[model samples]
Target: MEEKCTTLGKLELEAQNWFVKVIVAEKTPIRFLRWRRQQRLVFVDKENERMQSIIYEQDVDQLDKLLELYKTYHVGNAKIREITGNTPILGTSKHQMILSRSTYIKRTEEHERIPIDHIYQFTPFSELPEIADVPTKQINLLFSVIHVFPPRFVERTKRNLQDFVIINEERRALILTLWEEFLQSEAPYLTKNVHTMPILISFALKF
Candidate 1:
């Protein structure tokens, strides 16, 4: 039988007998109001490969059942299958696939753990001499917010809006620019007692 695949990584998802050990990196509702309609889950495999999968409306129950396991356990061994009648958008099959269902999932035992700490380490901002010098082209930063700027509109082809914020960890500080969607989604927390709140930037770019 031909193998199935995933959307973001185009990784071949074999049938029930083939298992992949992964860690849940993120999970978010597709829409704030109608969460059951669709949802997104991002995972990192043992090889440090990242991929995203969507939970369709029809699979909401599966998501509900898997949520606790994913959140509490962090790591799991999952059996992946491909969904039929689903194709990549725009005809580009680069890194996208429709998975049928998660046949099985269980907490990954200690012996099954893969040493991928180097790929997801939280490094001190000061340790990086320059953003351009980051080997992986991605950095994970964790710090407390120092200041946040109000949203501003810029004259662009589509009338763009931007938001700015400053974060600090001890003596290190970094300025972050947020676009409209991010500003709106994070506005509440950004405007509150931000100095006391800590945030982790999982994938931040130097540029």
Candidate 2:
């Protein structure tokens, strides 16, 4: 018999096992109707696909454990098993469709901490092939800050803040754009010592 495929929407109602290679993305508090409770933990698949899972007020202990693991070990790739519960779906919105009940996670791989000096050996900015020249959509880089421009207000669907910083290694210089949160936090520090400090940039996705 052929095995069935499980999607985010159908996990709870169907008594089936779904296996996925996931990395913990984030955990945030959420409000639901009159009940100002429940936490949402976000996960990204091996391919960088995102999904949000729900944890109720009663599951605060589980949340605490997960948070501790996240802080200490920096929750890397893991195998997660869903624990079906009678939790009601939060809303009829598109976001609600991606929410799932509690899960039991087991780390499949050990987290390896790479030394800061050795980062370039893994993914050097100099060796990055042009986007059109490469098959994959992602590239990693390590760069030093050359200059940082003032933060600017961009009018999107709503007003959004952005900052542009010029960074370079020995071979090339590139501009990195920081969105709202990163712009506010890191930009100030980076701008202050743009000429003196050495900044390393490594990203899993294409910027």
Candidate 3:
């Protein structure tokens, strides 16, 4: 039984757990459409200001039933704030806050657990600093060419090869897999070479 309280009122949603919360708040002209799934939710507020909303989640089949109950009456707490685009925040305690930052993240693979190799020198983008500064949870980036292990030990397929990497320390650099278009259009920049390193790119959790 998960506690479901509404901002308009303090009510519990025990039977039905409606994860998607769409808030059309009173006195505000912003549109906030929110939905939660797979531990990820899409919160959108077209207006450029702090918007208010409500949301709750649990396990149930009759999500619509719970949602209708919420619309008819008032449940969970209100005040789901969407202050800016790409950056979402929600109020939990009286004084605490939660920040949802979308960033470029790479996952570790079984082979990546050990050291691999990758190409080092790259054609640095002039606008990289500015693009990195923008407050965004997700950014699109690509790698030119990465030196990798011979096909003997590593398994790679047509497009999957572009998806591979080897993260060496400062000794060499990590170049992530760029999309096929970037790889094809900018083919000359990342030419395949036997000397390049083969490794994976991963994120060291930030505190």
Per-model TM against the reference: 0.55, 0.42, 0.21
lDDT of 3 by residue, 13-76 (tens): 2223322222221111112236542122222111211222332334222232332211222222
* Better candidate by lDDT, 1 or 2: 1
Candidates sorted on lDDT, descending: 1, 2, 3
What are the per-residue Cα lDDT tens digits for candidate 2 across 76-135?
122333433544222211232122224534444345321223212235555655562553
Pairs with steric clashes in candidate 1 = 6-96, 6-97, 7-95, 7-96, 7-97, 8-95
Find the number of clashing residue pairs for candidate 2.
0
Better of 1 and 3 by lDDT: 1
Name the candidate, 2 or 3, with the larger lDDT value.
Answer: 2
Runs with alpha carbons beyond 4 Å of true place in candidate 3: 1-38, 48-57, 60-126, 130-207
Q: Global lDDT of each model?
A: 0.51, 0.46, 0.27
Candidate 2 — worst ten consecutive residues by lDDT sum? 69-78
